[model samples]
Target: MRKFQNRSKLSQYLSEQRTKVSSIGFVPTMGALHIGHLSLVSKALSENDFVVVSVFVNPTQFDNKDDLVKYPRTLEKDIRLLKTLSENRIAVYAPTVEDIYENKVVSKSFSFNGLEHQMEGAFRDGHFDGVGTIVKRLFEIVKPDTAYFGEKDFQQLQIIKKLVELYHLPVKVIGCPIHRAEDGLALSSRNTRLTEAHREVAPFIYKTLNTAKVMFGTKSAQKVTAWVEKQFKKQPLLKVEYFIIADIETLKPVKRKSTKKSYRAFIAVYAGDIRLIDNIALN
Candidate 1:
């Protein structure tokens, strides 16, 4: 696999590639690659002629500077893992911050249209704006026919889909399933920072969502949410950020209703200062 650090070279390469290829699939990520990322790359490979995976830990996405500093950067190991995948189908774009954005100039001011003021957005503060801007920039640079995103960050997937619709971008937003570890914990690079105890407790986040799902199966939405909140309260280690049963697409809170349609149970918890996110369907 050829690596290009220079923005001009990479842009020229993709432009030239655009002339030869009928379609391109892009997976933009903040590196420290994991099974979840590979899952995205794999999906891209299946659907498009060229699969491009970007591994730039976007500074704009991080609300706190320390979080960005603590974020993993296993480039060597990541490249090795990517190499094991179909080499001809994959390309790595690891550009510096300047390559993506001009010196001191950034894309910060974003209007999420009320979607940014709830759940992850409300808590993270400008998190979705950072996410939206960076994603828009990436879409502009790559200009792929399709882009892949994991549902682990469910809200992010929602926001990107909205961004595409609002802007009328000529790219398809494909939401891939959230990959999980053998023990049921959602595969996340942040999980690497967890201690054994934290990791053990991490799966409970998924378990709690499952619990909510089961309760939703029998009980009303109000009761299900109350029970889930109580469960999170019981687990002192798992500092629950926000747990809600909402419409999967609009993300608006759903009232107690009898329907076998799509509903989502989103969660955010702090496992010893390392915040982790996971969501499950409550159908």
Candidate 2:
């Protein structure tokens, strides 16, 4: 696997590669590698002639400076993990912040339309703007035929779909399934920060979502939401940030039960100091 820190060199090399290869698959991520990341890489390796995985910890995405500062940086370990996957050569673009955001440090306003008004977009102000900027930038640089993203960030996935549509980018945005631990906790880079006991309790987020899923079959949306909040409160260590039952297409909260439309349950929680989020289908 060849590693490139410079975006220019990587882009130039890929430009030449475009002539030789039929298609290129891209998996863009923040540095701390996990099973979830590898799953995306696995799909990319299977589908395309060449694959490029980027591990740049984007500062613009985080609203809080401390969160960005404290975010995991396991570059050597991340590379070691990625090496286990690709049988053929894979390009690992671990670019510096300057390489990605030379003049543009802050995100310019992006219209994800009203999709940006709720969920993680609502809670984390300018979060999706940072997401849009970085992703659009990477898409331009990599110039891949297809890009892979995990559905753990469901809202972000939807927004990127919008980003491609708005700009008329040729890249295909393939939403891969959210990978989970054997116990059902969604695999995350942030899982590294959890203390031993908290790690054990983390799967409760998924457990709660699954429970809500079954409850939604008989109960009203409001009732299921209240039940979710009450259930989380029972665990002293876990605190519910927001438990939303919404339409999958529009992402607007759906209060009434309807047979015609598909629904989903999304949750964000604070497990001690670390915040975790998970979602499940209500159908």
Every candidate's CA RMSD: 1.5, 1.1
Candidate 1 lDDT over 130-195, as tens digits, reads 898889988888788999999999889889998998899999999999999987899999999998
Name the regions of candidate 2 deviating beyond 4 angstroms: none
Model 2 per-residue lDDT at 64: 77
> In candidate 2, what are the lDDT values of residues 156-208, reduced to their tens digit?
88899999999999999999999999999998888888988889888889988
Taken over the whole model, the C-alpha lDDT of each candidate is 0.85, 0.89
Residue pairs in collision within model 1: none
- Using all chains and alpha carbons, the TM-scores for the candidates as numbered come to 0.95, 0.97
